[model samples]
Target: MKSNPNFLFPKLASTIEELRQLSISEERKKVLRPLVLYIQRCVQESKTCNLNFICTHNSRRSQFGQIWAKVASEYFGISANCFSGGMEVTAFNERAVESLKRSGFKISSKGKGNPIYAVSFSENSDPIVCFSKLYDDRVNHVENFAAVMTCDHAEENCPFIPGAEVRIPLHYKDPKEFDGTDLEEKKYDERSMQIASEMFHVFSEAEKQG
Candidate 1:
C-alpha cells in the first residue's frame, strides 16, 4: 500500500486487483465503468473528485459504496477522496463493519463503544470515517464534489444538493432487511460481495481504456 496525503488513505493495490475478479450485475457494470473512468481522470489531473455516498441510514449501502470507491480508485491508480453520510442522523452500523471485515477490508475501531469503526481498505488508505451528522449539516461545505445517492429514499427526497457539481443516483437494496435473522451474516456478506464485484467490474473497464 502507498500513502497519499492529498487523499485520505493510501490505495490498497492488491485488494483492488482481487476485487476485480468478483461477479456482479451487468447493468451495474454498464453504468459504473464510464462513471469511474471520468472520476479517475478528474483525480489524476490533480482535481478533487470528492464523492459523497448518501443513503437514508448511511449504515450499509452507502458505506460499502464509499469504501469500494476508495479501493477501486487506488487499484486503478486513480486519485480521489471518498466519504459517506446519511440523510438522517445514524451511526455506522456494527453489522456493516463486521461484514466489511469478513470481506477482507482492514478496519480499525477509533472511538468508544466502537464509534462506528473507522474503516480503511489498507494501511495507507485513510479510514472511511464519518460524523454522526445529517447530509445537510454543513450546506456549503461539500459543494464542489459529486453527490451520489445510494438508496432510493435519499435519491428521491434529496433532488437538490447545494454546491454539488454532479448528482448521480446509484441505488442498492437495504441489507438491513436480514438483520436479527439466523442468516443475517450470510446476507450481509452476500450484499458486500455484490458491491465488491460491481466496483471491480467498473475499474476493470476503466483499465481497458489505457
Candidate 2:
C-alpha cells in the first residue's frame, strides 16, 4: 500500500488495502454506478464533490461511510467532501466509534449527547467533524450533492432529497443487530470494513475518470 503521511495510523493504510480485496456483488455494483457517474461528472467538470451519506440513525453505517469516503478520496488524491446524517438525530454510537478507533483513526469527542467527534485519518490533515443531525442540517451541503442512503428505512422514506441533484441507494445491512451479542465488536468492525471497501471503490473509480 502507498504510504500517506496524512493518515494518522499505519494500520489505516493497510486496512484499506485489505478492504479493496473484498468482493462487492454485481447487484450492489449496479446500484453504485449512479454514484460513480455523479462523481465522474463532478471531477470532469472540475466541480466540488459533496456526498451526504444518510441512514435511519447516523450512528453506524452512515458514519463509517462518510469517514471512509473522505479517507479514500484523499488516498486516491481526489478532492471531495463527505458528510453523514440521519432521518433523526442520534449520537454516533459508541460501538461504531470504537470500531473506527480499532481501524486506526484517531478520534476525540466533546459535548454530551450527540457530541461532536473530530476523527483524524492523518496527522497533518484536518480531522473530519462528525455529529448526528438531520440530513438537511445547516452544517452539510444544501444543494447539488449526492445523497447516499446507507440503510433501507432512510432510502424508503427519503425518496426525494430536495436539493440533491443525484440520489443513490447504496444500502447496507445494519450491524446494530449484533449490539449485545457475543459478536458485537466483531460485527461492528466488519460493517466498518465493508463500507470502507465500497467507498474506496467509489472514489478510486472517480480518480480514474479525473
Candidate 3:
C-alpha cells in the first residue's frame, strides 16, 4: 500500500494536518493501542483490516469513528474496510454532519427518515456511504472484523459480537448532551476533532509497526 496524500481534498488535508498536531492523552493511547496492534497484525498477514464502529444509537460517535478510521488508514497507506452500526437504527445526527463539514469533509445525503450520506474527504477516492443500521447490517462485513465500541452503552449492551475477531472499547463522551443548548456546535466539533486526532494517532502507530 502506498500513502496517498493526493487522494484528499486540499482543505481536508490541511484540516487533517491540524488534527495530527492535537494531543492524545496516555489513557486514550492505551485504549487505542489494541487497535494499532490489530492493524499491524493485519499488515503482517497481508490481510484487509476491517473495522466496525458500533454505538447504541449509531448517530454520533460511531459514525465519527468509522469515517476517521477509514481516513486515518488511507492516509497512512494501509488497506482497511471501515463501517459503523448500532443496537438500534436512527438517522445520523445532523449536528454531527455539520461538524464534519466544518472539518472540511464533503457530505451529501438522500432518503427520508434515515438518509444515506455520501461522505468524502478526498477528491480521488470514492465517498463513504453512511447510514444508521444494526451492527449486523448486510452492508457490513460479517466476519473477520474488529468490533470497536465507541460508546459505553453499546460496549456494555453488546456482550458478544458474533463475527468480531477482537472487541475494543474506545468510548467517547456524547455531544448529544448539548443538543439544544448554545454549546451544541462547539461540543460537536470538539468531539469530532477529538475522534479524528486519536484515530490518526492509531494509524500513525500502526504504520510505524508495519
Sort all candidates by TM-score, best to worst.
3, 2, 1
Q: Write the per-residue lDDT of candidate 1 for residues 26-116, one digit (tens) a residue.
A: 7776656556666756645667567777888777888787787776667666556777778777767788888877666667766654265
For residue 188, model 2's alpha carbon misses the true position, in angstroms, by: 0.7
In model 2, the worst 10-residue window by lDDT is 1-10
Write the residue-wise lDDT of candidate 2 on 72-98 in tens digits.
878877778898899999899999999
Clashes of each: 5, 4, 0
lDDT head-to-head 1 vs 3, winner: 3
Q: What are the models' TM-scores? A: 0.80, 0.94, 0.97
**Candidate 2 TM-score, C-alpha based:** 0.94
List all candidate RMSDs to the true structure.
4.4, 2.0, 1.0
The residue-by-residue lDDT of candidate 3 on 121-180, one tens digit each, is: 887889999999999999999999999999999998889999999999999999999999
Model 3 is weakest, by summed lDDT over 10 consecutive residues, at: 1-10
Runs of candidate 2 exceeding 4 Å displacement: 1-8
lDDT against the true structure, per candidate, is 0.68, 0.86, 0.93
